[model samples]
Target: MAGETRIWTPIDYEADGKQSDCLRLPHSTDLSAYGWVPIPLVCIKNGTGPTALLIAGNHGDEYEGQIALSNLARETRHHKVSGRLVILPALNFPAVAAGRRVSPLDEGNLNRSFPGDAAGSPTQMIAHYVCAVLIPMADIVVDLHSGGRSLDYVASALVRPGRTAEEHEKLLRLMRLFGAPISFISDGTGGGGLTTLAAAAQEQGALALTTELGGGATLSKAGLALAEAGLKRLLKDQEILRDVAVEPASPTRFMTVRGHSAFVYAPSRGIFEPAADIGAEVLGGQIAGRIHFPDLPTREPETLFFETSGLVACRRAPSLTERGDCLFKVMADIDVGPDQVSHA
Candidate 1:
């Protein structure tokens, strides 16, 4: 952990102290120089054991996760932590303000640009900074997220596959601490990459998990409360905080996806009418939605059916469909090893 002590740029480590200002990344430009900007990172570091980093705002449209993280920072500012707590309330500052998924400058999705490049696109630089600086310093990491922009998702903890029974149990315990109703283990649903910071942390052998709230291009008090309470539970479970009373997790059924499930799409251009809701279980050959032609009012619309059985984890909001556009994604139930899958 000697080399791991320093993350990203140059910032001296101060145990359990507040810094009134954020440290600015060198050569970071404002909107005047480039079409985008990087704001100084406002970090609150506390405690002195293994570090745990809490991050949010990777996708601008997922506002609830960011807000939840921000709210936790405010409530726990004076918290006496046992381990180092690094809070990056908002990583994609510009995107959060604009309410979009990708960086507005190059329209790049920041989550996909891991271990970023200084001379690359704006999003790339952000990935580089987070991967190089913040991630290396932590023993465990919890990334906050939700469906971006036009998608709606059920709240769940997406964990990697192929863990020993102990690892799996530990992860489940963490999920219960997250206080979410569902926990979907990511059995290679998201491919390995340099784009996502979560992947970067996992690659370093950290106990990493991504907590997704229920929101897309919107925010809600319920979602925010879940996020805050989940973090508190995690911190307490990690032994970083001493006085939190965490509820024992109820018996949970962990489902694994058999393979890359399909996101049902529009067969033709027209308005889409979905018949199912998020988190609803569907069967193979089930009619989930229909595609209607705007001009051909007299002609009957085409109904779309599911090819496999699983949960409807994501669905388009407008119920309006476009040709070849995905309207729903089915997460089929299957068994997979925790180490066998990695969502980089």
Candidate 2:
């Protein structure tokens, strides 16, 4: 460790580190209206192991995942890592400030605009920075996420396809290192968005995994704890840290959703009453929820049901409902087979 240079990217932040006051890296530019956001690309420069990136807050509303990655950056400052660790805890600052799903001005979901252009919109510029700057430099990328808005996500991982079976297995090992309770595998390329930055890392042949830690808007202690444990596991798995323990689960149960899936929505506007819970299995034509028409005869409540069979991955919020509103999403199981399909 004598020859190693532990470089911390200095930025214009508050004394308590709550606010971003200035750019840490001297070479900073205002890409858009978001002001001088710091691109904290620090490195140990030992030149001995793999370089890994941990990113979060692609969607501003997912606070738990953002907090987990932020805490990791703060706690591991003095740790002797085997390789480089780049942490971008909050990528969408404006949106995070508003506690909204997408940027308020452009009304763009940063996750959807991937490999963004420099001269495009503000979100595009950020996307462009991510793709052009941090991504290419990473050897392994872990994009952290949580349910944005009014939803909660069970812990899961989404991996890209096209890796060799051996490489796929290796990717799974790294995903497990995060130690999420449930590990879901889908092709990373399927979703065309800025959030698919993990897939971009995979495209570069860097072992990548995108994880969902908890729900949206708020932080859960259990979710944060799981992510903290998982990150340490990942650090040990990548040889960036020592004395870490791996939570062993032989034959890890991973659910796969391949190809196009049906998203069930409420056909008629009414108060929504859901019958099934998240992670529930359903048969085709299963009655999922009811849209009770307010101030009606109440004899014919509009029934919402699944068209195909799978799991209830996501559901709409609350008693409020509108015509053509999404009630729940059903992902029909497909064969991933030898070919890997890109999933979001």
Best by lDDT: 1
Off by over 4 Å in 2: 1-47, 188-195, 245-251, 258-262, 295-299, 331-337, 340-344
Candidate 1 lDDT tens digits, 1-344: 11221114334556456443443433334545423244434445565677788888888888777777666666665356676777776677667668888867678787777766766766666776667667778877888888776777777677764247777666656765676766667634334343467667777767777866776567766667777777777787778776866565444345544454456777888888898898899998999888888798898989998877888877886666667776877765544335434221
The weakest ten consecutive residues by lDDT in model 1 span 1-10
TM-score of each: 0.85, 0.80
Predict model 1's lDDT versus the native.
Answer: 0.67
TM-score, cand. 2? 0.80
Of the candidates shown, which would achieve the greatest TM-score relative to the real structure? Answer: 1
Clashes (N, CA, C under 3 Å) per candidate: 22, 11
